[model samples]
Target: MTAGIDLGHPQAQAIQSDEDVVRVRQLVRTVAVAARLSLVDQTKLVTAASELARNTLVYGGGGVAEVTTVDNGRRRGIRIVFADDGPGIVDLDLALTDGYTTGGGLGLGLSGARRLVDEFDIVTGSGQGTRITVIKWSR
Candidate 1:
């Protein structure tokens, strides 16, 4: 496990299939527990990770997820970055809105994941794929 104080190197896992998504969830849970996050916080982070991982596999056309432990002196947190080289999202706004999905899903993956984390960021363009980063801080 990487120390929270070290922000230079993060652990990464490839998200290529359903099994990969499960592995991502386990990795996130491990890191979250190691960070001494509350059970509720851990669950939130895990749920968010699972959603993002599935999105990476289903929509992003497979990618990698980087997990890192973070510390801001007084607080500790877990950060995850999901990146994939899919077709990319054409409408960011529409994608983020509730009840919107191109794959006939519940449309809660992106927006719901965002709500579960303390920080969220997304980068994507036409044919450029997508990258999403999220963080959960321990309370």
Candidate 2:
């Protein structure tokens, strides 16, 4: 297995409520801008972060999101991880499907977020809560 590079220390934000989601988006946007990402890329990352943050608040019963600057020798990217301790997803495949939602939403949040970012990873079990990580590389 290829070893993961050491990304710099991450900045964390609490996601206990809707207000925290807004704060996350703002923080993501600021970091995206500071990284000199394109306007479109910045928006994509911010939008994805918003969706995941909301999921943490609504479905996960609140959580914490960690934001970090990543460098893989050749490229720089931003990685955001949303983690919660609430009940976890029951079906990983179904949850990632395009039109699957347990929250009466349009079912576009997770799939759409995956489309927006360059990398995505999720970990969850029936009662283990949920954790999602996404990254967008600078152009």
Model 2: per-residue lDDT, tens digit, 1-139?
1123547678899999889999999999988898788999999999999999999999999999998877777777898999999899998889889988999998888999999999999999999999998889888
Clashing pairs in 1: none
Question: Model 1 — which ten-residue stretch has the worst lDDT?
Answer: 1-10
Q: Model 1 segments beyond 4 Å from truth?
A: 1-8
> Which candidate's TM-score is highest?
2
Q: What tens digits encode model 1's per-residue C-alpha lDDT throughout 15-120?
A: 9889999999999998889889999999999999999999999998899999998987778899899999999889999999989999989999999999999999
Residue range with the least summed lDDT across 10 consecutive positions in model 2: 1-10
How well does model 2 score by local distance difference test?
Answer: 0.90
For each candidate in the order shown, give its overall lDDT on alpha carbons: 0.91, 0.90
Best by lDDT: 1
RMSD of each: 3.2, 1.6
